[model samples]
Target chain A: MDSLLTLLPMLVKMAIVVGVLLLLPLPLTWMERKIAAHIQQRPGPMRVGWHGLLQPLADALKLLTKEDHIPADADRRLFAMAPVVALVPPFLVFTAIPFGTPVQLFGQEVTLMISDMNVGLLFILAVSGIGVFGTILAGWSSNSKYAVLGSLRSIAQMISYEIPMGFSVIGVVMLAQSMNLSQIVAAQEGLWNIVLQPIGFFVFFVAGLAEAQRIPFDLPEAEGDLGAGYHTEYSGIRFSLFMLAEYLVVVMLAALNVLLFFGGWNGAPPFVPEPVWFLLKVGFFVWVFMWFRFTFPRYRYDQLMTIGWKVLLPLSLLNILVSGLWML
Target chain B: MEQAFFLLLAAVAVTAALLVVLARNPIHSALALVACLVQIAALYVLLGAPFLAVIQIFVYVGAVMVLFLFVIMMLDVRKEAQVRFLRGPLLPGLVVLAVLAGEMIALLLHSTRLHAVMGPGQPVLEQPSVADLSLLLFQEYLLPFEVASVILLVALIGAVVLAREDGASAAKAARKEPRGAAR
Candidate 1:
């Protein structure tokens, strides 16, 4: 009972983290539709509620009431498990990321993050691997040829891109000389990593875009080619889980990009609180994600592979060498 | 409390390992292997080697296991389980297993003696960071590390050669024989 009581605050904090993540996707979905509509010269989601702000809510209601699907040929257990498994790893990565500098609460420092491990960046990379498993499992369990093919593309893309992403991060780590996310953030208070490692930042952002499978890099869920790709068999809430994870990965990567490259919570501010600054920086990157979605045509399959390996990989390796020399 | 956590992990690890072998479907077996690997990573965390635990997940569970699942899914090995388990190599397998088990038991006994020499519970050693491990690899075990990497490079080249050779042979077989090609 005592231990449980002691653990209550931590549990509540975790609940808040997950709750905020869940709620963010609603507004994000609405914003995505609105932005896409404006870009294409049309009004989007104006009927559901005021400016379609409540559209996500209506969509949620519809998804919840829809019949849960289980195909007859599908493996029963893995089919059920895939959506949930997809959600866990990104959430785990979220915990290690620091939202802002620690705040003072009752004369003690209260951190916005769940835990600050010395190897927080490594933890993020490791958990992302698990997310890849979740994607592969979803494809295999669906027992659909299209789903399997999409998943194969995703696996190859993720594996190849992860190398560049890892190299890009190593450059940042070398500059910062620490893997702790908060320390990395603190180190950027003076000049930000962007000024020092611009190439690394660009590489990290592109690799992150690929890692999340957004837009041009979204071969795994290529709607036109693979009939919704890797998730053709899914419907209702199970399908929503994949979308939710997709948005969460986007948000998480945006926040990480802000923290790593841009000055995290460091701005020309005498008014806004630190967390708000962090959010604003993240918000800018979120808009960038939407902008990229509308602008580019999706790459062909082989082209995507070539860019990941031949282009980004070599560039990231060069960035690491440049960063090392610059730091010395 | 620590012991309780350890017990929980141990039970899950053993059960998942059993499922890895006992489950008939190859996909199920691969998933079981993932479970077992995750539990082992948790055990590493408990042992205060957090760096090792994360690497274990990153390299083995995250990357290698995905590849394993891919190959298994592509091969569709579920229909190939017609033969009885351990039928052909039953005797030698049992002998090897017994010897392994005996070695494990002896090690456990030796560990208990070592504990007696120190105290009841094993003390927590100073935690090593990633920098320390990297330094050790580059500075102390530099030659061995370079040699290992060279070996990996060799294996990578070998795999490419073998794959190309197989593809060439399959093309030849298809043109000449029209059946019994590759498979």
Candidate 2:
């Protein structure tokens, strides 16, 4: 009876988290279009609802009703499974993220997260990286040259950028002296780690942009070269699922950036609720992500690789060395 | 309950690992590896080594294996080509497998005799904190860490050198291009 009581709040929290995470992509998708429209000097979906609030819902309904199409020569099983594979990891990663302090409900202190693994940072990274496999598999199974090329390009970009991204976080890990995201955030109680680790933050931010497959680093999905990257063969809800995964990744990266650099739930005096502060920080990063998409041009393949390997990797290494010496 | 969870996790880990080896396509293999990694992480949780589990997933599954998948995809090594390995080198592989199994069995038997005090009722083995791991890494293991860094640096340099197109070859190719251009 006691165990069941303890488990109930956990179930509730998990439901809430999943519910919120699933919903966030809707607004984010709308935001992407609206932002792009505004950037291009257009009104952007004002008709759907008040300021096009229901546009994403409308889009969803349309996609849901659309005919599911599969290529004749595609590997049927892998093709069917690819979207599920892509979608699960991002959802799984949300489990470890601590939203707020534990709340007492029915005589049990229920954590506001699904799971609080010690290696929260690593878990996020690992799960997110696994998402790439789905993309690669989708491309391979599609038996389309363009899809394969796009997938290859994306995988290469992700792998190249991840080194610098990992290294960038090493400085934060060094300073926080822990790999636990919650602990790392807690360590920045007084001062945010971003102030201390600006270079690390910068590298991570850039690497994240590449990882999210946003513009400038969005060579994989460049419409000019590769038609819609790994999802070229996908249509209907499967296509939506891929897009949802991408946006969720954007959110995840933003949240992670906030957690790592911006002192996740930490805020000024008067103590804004932790979740609000966390959301605000995440929102800020997401906006910045949108801004980057608007601002930068797609990088050429060679140039992208050069920036990742030549510029970001060496800079991150230097940042680590400098931080290590400083700490010593 | 905990024991049941551990057994389930172990089953998942083993199955995923087997799938990683058995998968025909490289992409499928990579996906299986990811499953194996996540299951291993679950096992880590069951063992109360949450930190190690997370790091295992993060470093090995996330970064390193992603690179492996990326390379495999880029190379586009055919699934049929990869299968040929099963046909060759059977004896050496069996010997290696036997040696590994023997070592693991020996280690398990040895550990059973040494009854170290663990946290009461729980399999909590007083594992070092992240701070302790970092301290040990940067202090005691500093030389080895530095050596590994140097090795990685050398590999990076070698890769760049190998990938670069030679100036003389480019010049020769440019010279040959004019013959076709004149027509």
Alpha-carbon local distance difference test for all models = 0.87, 0.83
Model 1 DockQ (Cα-based): 0.74
Taking every candidate in turn, the Cα RMSD to the unseen true structure, in Å, is: 3.0, 4.2
Report residue B70 deviation for candidate 2 (angstroms): 3.5
Question: Candidate 1 lDDT, tens digit per residue, B1-183?
Answer: 889999999999999998988787888888999999999999999988889999899888878888888788778565754533556757898899899999988876778775677676767767777788889989999999999999999999999999999999998877877554545
Per-residue lDDT of A1-328 in model 2, one digit per residue for the tens?
Answer: 9998768777887888778878888899888889989999998899999999999999999999999999998888989998988898889889888876666767767776787766677778767877787787788788888898888888788788878988899999888877777888889889998999999999999999998888888877788878887889999999988888988899999999999999888874476877887888899899889978988888788999999999999999999999999999
Candidate 2 global TM-score: 0.85
| Residue A321, model 2, lDDT | 97
Per-prediction tally of clashes? 0, 0
lDDT of 2 by residue, B74-145 (tens): 675674536733566689888998999999888766765443443246544575576777788899999999
The sequence of per-residue lDDT tens digits that candidate 1 reaches over residues A137-210 is 88888999888888888888888888888888888898778889888888888898898888888888998999
Clash count in backbone of candidate 1: 0
Indicate which candidate wins on lDDT. Answer: 1
- The regions of model 1 sitting more than 4 angstroms off are A1-8, B81-85, B88-95, B110-127, B171-183
